[model samples]
Target: MALDALGSPAAARDGMLDVTRDGRPSARIHVTSRGGEGRALVLVHGAGVDGSFFGGLASAFAGRRVVTYDRRGCGVSSDALDGDWSLDAQAADLAAIIRKAGAPADVVAHSLGSLVAMRALELAPGLMRRLVLIEPPLFVGLDPADPVFQNLVRAGQALAKGHTSTLFMLALERENMGDAIRPFTQDELAFRERDVQTHADHEAGWMLAYKPDLARIRAQGVPVLLCMSERSASTYHARNQDFLARGMGADLMRLPGGHNAPRDYPDEVATRLSTWL
Candidate 1:
């Protein structure tokens, strides 16, 4: 099933691509491709979201081959984790996807997805021509004593202790989006529930523990466009993006709307992406 411009199901080209790592079967990823020309641009979604999250954004790139896929267990991708689900594993999955979609692709990754793309770039150099990272949550450089960071850590701990994923995600949205938070439709809620069951635990645990190899990424010299939302309520993400921009020597672009700008402001995001990519 292909997703429409608003991320709803519609008729379009879709396929299931098998991803492998170290000569072993890794995942059977559900991929959707659209548009006409230019370098293949892949959209990598963040935690608790799937390829459908980029449906609207994907439609905006009219002339570029835009590929969006459900990352491993998210959406319709294979859910058999086989007890090995970490950021590194996700990065490998991404590398395989990039190779299948067309190597030297341009990537636009959001939130935790940015981390996965960065890791993939480090692991598979020259696979990506350009990268656009949107608000990666890197708490490594932040002061642990800060109240905002403390709250975020506590929320993760709650999830680790079996706190309700719905409530956890609601709290997260409130924190990040503040008054801009909107009600999720029934389908959106269902997707969120499935994603939470599949990835929330790992996201709260090992994913948070994973750190990027900034030095290796810098050495590769892949052009990066770091994006942050103008109305994001969280200081954690803003500070982290600033740190990342400086560390990677990336060109930073500020877009309107909250952290989920692709959903809320697809036109603006696409315009900026077209200019950058």
Candidate 2:
């Protein structure tokens, strides 16, 4: 289980298969190495999306032993996990993954996973050497008074009604539809549908329950790079990224494409991240 050989399909980067919490019927953990000798760098995906969302960044850091896995109820992970399903739960899952893999490595988390990673650092301050977050949704939290919250609630309700296909269609038409969604691959569609369904239900509970605990994350004293899309300039995502950057006292960098840049333009995202890496 040397750190360099972490890409075997049959085993995780650490050559171990440890299930931390398993009350769900289909709970599983996946870990793969992108290749490197130093401490492993783990990538945690955002809400609705699975670990594949980091395709671009993953490929970019192929030289490093990068690990990315689906969170509970998303993608290959189980949806039947009990309890509140808050960020803390995800953070605990991450801590387990880290422990199973080894201990204390860098982490690159996106959106919802960023919140989870932040909480992980709070629970175990030595869990990560550094952090890279892209467009975390925690800045605004869940504003019940905001129209976006209403829209999310409505969308969740629709997906709960078995309207994932319809929701996927709207997402394709309205969203930028990165390579991950183009030409409508069945696998991609199925994955997207799962993400939509997950977000539409109990997964939303984790997102909506997030409260900014900036002091806790700062206390970890880890170097953090906050990133967002250059195209998000005109959108509220820009303001949100700025808010998160200021709140976390981290550097903010911009990448090409919109919110789905990691899928649409992984090369470019990887190029920008190389400077930091």
What lDDT score is found at residue 254 in candidate 1? 88
Clashing pairs in 2: 73-78
Worst 10 residues of 1 by lDDT: 2-11
Provide the TM-score for each candidate, comma-separated: 0.87, 0.77
lDDT of candidates 1 onward, in order:
0.75, 0.65
Q: What residue runs in model 2 are displaced by over 4 Å at the alpha carbon?
A: 1-17, 21-27, 80-84, 141-187
Model 2 compared with the native: what TM-score?
Answer: 0.77
Candidate 2's C-alpha lDDT?
0.65
lDDT of 1: 0.75
